[model samples]
Target: MSQMTSQTHAIAPEDADRAVIYGFVGRLLQAPPSAGDMDVLRALTADETEMGLALKSLSEAAQSANVNSLKDEYNALFIGLGRGELVPYGSFYLTGFLNEKPLAELRADMGVLGIARADTVKEPEDHIAALLQCMEGLITGAFGEPATLPIQEKFFTCHIASWAPHFFKDLTAQNTSAFYAAVGALGGVLVALETEAFGMAG
Candidate 1:
């Protein structure tokens, strides 16, 4: 996981909320949730909003989740013997292959934005979790000063908007999914909400 720097600038409440959700989903996708993580999920509250309902479902899923079972599910769904049920990389989603142009493009953008993959991380930089965490950092000034809305919109449009929604849709549809289905549902809603909000900003 990326170790983001301390926040230097104050983020707007809405942007802070966005950062929290992005961070939450990014962390969840990176690995199976630990018992403590499950406890956090189970404590989540919900309202009638679409995002809230997704949260409610996730909370329910977490309440019933077994740690060992979740580990198996995570392995089956994301990391299998040869390959998992899904390839959670942006390049594969965009190009039907890994280490393609999409990843190169993302790396180039990362250079420009002062984002760098940690030396400890073995996975490619284009993993969905990495990209989402990058966005969270941008929103919260973890990379530097918080990125402006236009900057955020540009990154989202170029990197996430094109493929993440479809990826989440696929995740939700997977037979191997149990706790992850709720994750996918929440991810879908978040991407949709971000897309719409960015559109309005544009």
Candidate 2:
């Protein structure tokens, strides 16, 4: 239930789309989708693109799914004993380990960005969910900055583009992923869209 803030200009259509992507992905990773969330998604409409089709599928699945079922699936896919079907960590995805140099590097850059861990957060800074939250803040100036697209692009290219898409691909392919498979599809498509959009920038 975090509110993204923006100043200095109108919220572009694309920026809103980015927020939706980041927010949904962050929420999906942070917790299981509630019955209320499923209801909200079911009312959403999708256009005729690959990403839109994926979203349409997500909406359909959410409509048919209940909170308890999703909660159990979430536990299996992300919170199983010892480990889950997917680690969902940049350090794990990039280096085959947790708390590795990628995390160190992200921390150093976060320092530059004036980012800090909340006292309530016990998770690592390099967790994919946390990183996506950071991206949402960057794009929306939720952390009290200019919300420069270039800065957002740099942060994404450095911290996220390296492994998140592959992680999504893996998530999509995992047997335990029912609701999350649609999440993976949307995440992968959004990341690719961001990558291409950034590449088009001068």
lDDT of 1 at 164: 99
Tens digit of per-residue lDDT, candidate 2, span 94-124: 9999999999999898888877887778878
Summarize candidate 1's per-residue lDDT along 1-202 as a digit string, tens digits.
Answer: 5547776788789999999999999999999999899989999998989999999999998888898999999999888999999999999999999999999999999999988888799999888999899999999999999999999999999999999999999998887867999999999999999999999878
Model 1 C-alpha RMSD to native: 0.9
lDDT of 1: 0.92
Model 2 weakest 10-residue run by lDDT: 1-10
Q: What are the lDDT figures for the candidates, one per model? A: 0.92, 0.83
Index of the highest-TM-score prediction: 1
Q: Give me the displacement of residue 158 in model 2, in angstroms.
A: 1.0
Model 1 clash tally?
0
**Candidate 1 regions off by >4 Å?**
none
